[model samples]
Target: MAVKTNCNINGIDYYRLRVTIGKDRKGKDVIKNFYGTSKTDAENQKDGWMKNKLLGINHISIRDSLSMAMFNWVWDVLKVSGIKVTSFERYEGIYRNYVEESSLGFMILEDIQRVNVQRCYNKLHEQGKSYSQIKNLHKVINMFFKYAVIEGYLLRNPCTGIKLDVYKKEEDVGEIDLFIEDEGTVETFTDEEIPVLLEGIKNKKLKIMVKFALGTGLRQGEILALKKTDIKNMVVQVTKTLSFAKLYDDADNYSYETIVTRPKTKKSIRKVPIPTELKKDLAELNKIRIEEKLKLGELYQDNDLLFPSETGTYIDSRNLLRSWKRAFEGIDVPYKKFHALRHTFATQLIKNGAQLITVSRLLGHASIKTTEIYAHVTESTKADDVQSLNSLFK
Candidate 1:
């Protein structure tokens, strides 16, 4: 009979079972330990082991080491967890890039400590990975350990106490000026730059896309996923987003496919009101689309997309971005990423005295904190108001 005993390690309570196998060559008993979160769990583990031994089957626990556990967890568990395809790819990428080849990954599950996880993050930071990247990596690793702990594979999550902030480095102000800025600093076209941008774009389709993005504050993916039926009564319903993901076949061959998935979050499914001016523009665009369909006469592949490729399939995001850059040719205004159009929409709203909460709902942000990035625009507006007061005093 296997002996089961209550045990505590690192403040975690569990049960340990000691089993005696056949004696060694020297007539000494061979002992093995199986651990679990409770006595019944330990007994079940021991029973399974005994059954495997009786059948002459070699059974290795996934919790034996970090790499083995992570591989199984990612492929066997997380892959089928109903997450978006892009999200699965991101987690797999982080494991391949940061964890699988690292020293901590090779460590035994029991030997992994908080310091080991912290060291991994420190190394990533030292390698010039951005704070956001490290933070995302931490999220994946933490979830991995948390799952282990819940399954009794680990006594506690080694990632629980790790501090990511300590690994963050202060940005150099000079470097910021030289390089393109991050989302922390929202960039948008000025009122003067808008007309210049519109007139400069050579492709009529790309021009309409830009105008729609500016007016509605929809993400590039959301705009690309739009169907003609998604708009009704001068409102656009943002229910889905288009994504391009690299996927692997059973034979390990990789290919890219365009997928239409639900909006990023529940809030992203809300409707956005279309401006009166953009409504007229869309009606005109619809007429042009009808003309193109008739001209193509069975050659066109109609997907009913509001904005589709020349043949009516999904537009490749890369091609759109490339065309966008070329659209700025010989133009006076500096080029910004397509996302800047959405940023500009939010900023313009804030400047026009729209309430922050209202703006947050309009933009479909999951949290108000995300919308608060544009609060600085309000501060700048306040400074202008102060200047007007100074003029009045004069």
Candidate 2:
């Protein structure tokens, strides 16, 4: 049972509930304090503490553990803070991927020292986790403890002044002819592959999507969420991105629910210039869409998406991937991510003597550093540069 002490501090009312957490080495009653503005709030807090103790909750003996603290803070605070839906989902994903499955979740908040958290990170590294993966886990855990400390759930955060390092394993030296360096180069499709990809895509609408991806570096969700109004006066405005709640693909049916939200970052809301050739193609696409809408008559469902299904509703992202796979069926080029098209767009501009800042702006990159990742030096381009050395040798 917790004892409530009512006090008046300089005309302000305050209530404190002190609960017996455990016995110390000296046989003293180890206590935990929860303060509130009202007596009922103090009692409620005490009652909740008692309930946790009775229910054998591991994380709530005195203070919340990593699991409870993270979840409670997220659901109680982050959800109500009006964060973007996509960012909130990503934050939740970190908790699910890192804390939910780890041993650190059940440990007492005070008992978890810096070394204990470090070992957890080391275990993740040994389990072949990437640096980015471990970093995300660290981020969530770090923020969780910070929240706990701020809310008086814990005295100090264990994650304070800590660093994570993931050790990468060496692959077999003779297994492959050439090793792919992680950050040494950016991967993009060759000029020849573009034609094959376009030709392989039978659907005219899907073909237009691939062309747009190559022409502009819009993200998958951004492109899927585009509307007829988004394109105007030889320019495409990227304003919002589509958020998918869940996706289910069955043998007979496929479906998804989407929530349209603002673009991921501030830079993602910029406008991209549509080339002259692409403008003409888009004009023709509009004509085709007008003809289709007339044929469907009252049965057509118009969501105003630039690229919609025959029924005029937003296209399912998964179904769009099926179409993407069909487009690459006969292509001889190696498999690359769909995002590689964005890289291709940037690389073509750089190869044709376009400025770095120009490409950065066109891609809606927040910083020029991000755009640099898409800029790669090809072997052929290097060879051309090496030829310039011939004059110096003479």
Candidate 2, 181-261: lDDT as tens digits: 112235688888888777777888888877888888787788889999998887899998876853323111234368888
Give each model's clash number.
0, 0
lDDT of each: 0.77, 0.69
Compute each candidate's TM-score over C-alphas: 0.76, 0.73
Winning model by lDDT:
1
RMSD score of candidate 2 (Å): 12.3
Candidate 1 lDDT tens digits, 1-394: 6545486544555576677866754678766566666678777867876786698653346434465467667876888788888777778888878877566665557777888778778877888877767777788888998887788777888888788666555532111210112244568898899999999998878888999999899989999999999999989999999989866541134578999988767888999998988877897778768877888889999999999887788999999989999988899999898999998999889888899998888887877767776876556767886888877666
lDDT of 1: 0.77
Residue 221 accuracy (lDDT) in model 1: 91
RMSD of each: 10.8, 12.3
Q: Cα miss at 248, model 1 (Å)?
A: 3.0
